[model samples]
Target: MSNLAPSLTAARQLADEYPNHKVTLLLLTDFQLFDADINRVLTDIATFPGDVHAVVLGGTQVDGLMDERVQITKATYTDPPGTVARAIFASLVNHRPGARPI
Candidate 1:
């Protein structure tokens, strides 16, 4: 899905449901695909304690969205999944070595 709002909400819900476990969300989409206010999405993402990363296709990166929790990539049609995988792997290697995805 283009919008991250719904996914973010679901991730938050999952986190709430499993308070003792880690909750992570990986979102892949085209840039500017948010159906809700970008500010609200950003706020939700920023406040989220669990991991959240994104691979966004083709658009200027939002100023505040590339923090420790978010990774946006401009995916190419030829290898969108590869692009996302690389982004996720890079984030993991750089940020949390030896960590496995949940």
Candidate 2:
């Protein structure tokens, strides 16, 4: 759901169809993801037309390789999905004014 245009398009459509529900997009930045391009990431966030939030944390990697990390079972802080679940819940409950993406 982090693929910028497609994601925002889908979320916007869903949100419009279901105005009673909260729609959010959680993006994880790093010490970077495997493809970790800070410029593109920032651009995507800035250009997004829907609710989006970010959590920057250390990424799990070894020698700049993803396969190695997967073999080692190392976890990114935002893995397991539940971590993101909690963040979404928190954001919904305590939203700061002007913090949402436009």
Candidate 3:
């Protein structure tokens, strides 16, 4: 969602600070340079102590889906923001049981 640098930094910090907490990151933006950075972040998060889940909303190509520890969701701006959020939330809740925040 944020720029690559901030996103990575935040993810690292969160993973470090709250190792026992479940962490989910949502990246929603458009950039051709995000692939490598996102991959690195995901790798780091997966190695963190807690459970880390990431949903990438605007990626073009993803190479690691069978890893079981990380997930990547590629989405475009084909609908309104509200619709997009709903869809993302639905998918997340479906894939990750008890992930929805009420």
Highest lDDT: give the candidate number. 1
At residue 40, candidate 1 shows an lDDT of 80
lDDT of each residue in 19-101, candidate 2, tens digit only: 66555555553434333454554455454444655543454333433222111222365577566556655556544555652
- Candidate 1 residue-wise lDDT, 20-97, digit = tens: 866556666665654758778778877786676666766546556556656555666667456667776765654465
Model 1 ranges off by over 4 Å: 65-68, 77-81, 88-102
Query: TM-score ranking from best to worst?
Result: 1, 3, 2
The positional error of residue 65 in candidate 3, measured at the CA in angstroms, is 8.6
- Between candidates 1 and 3, the one scoring higher on lDDT is 1
User: lDDT scores for all predictions?
Assistant: 0.67, 0.47, 0.54
Question: Which candidate has the highest TM-score of all?
Answer: 1
Per-candidate Cα RMSD to the true structure, in Å, reads 4.2, 10.6, 4.9
What are the per-model numbers of colliding residue pairs? Answer: 0, 0, 2
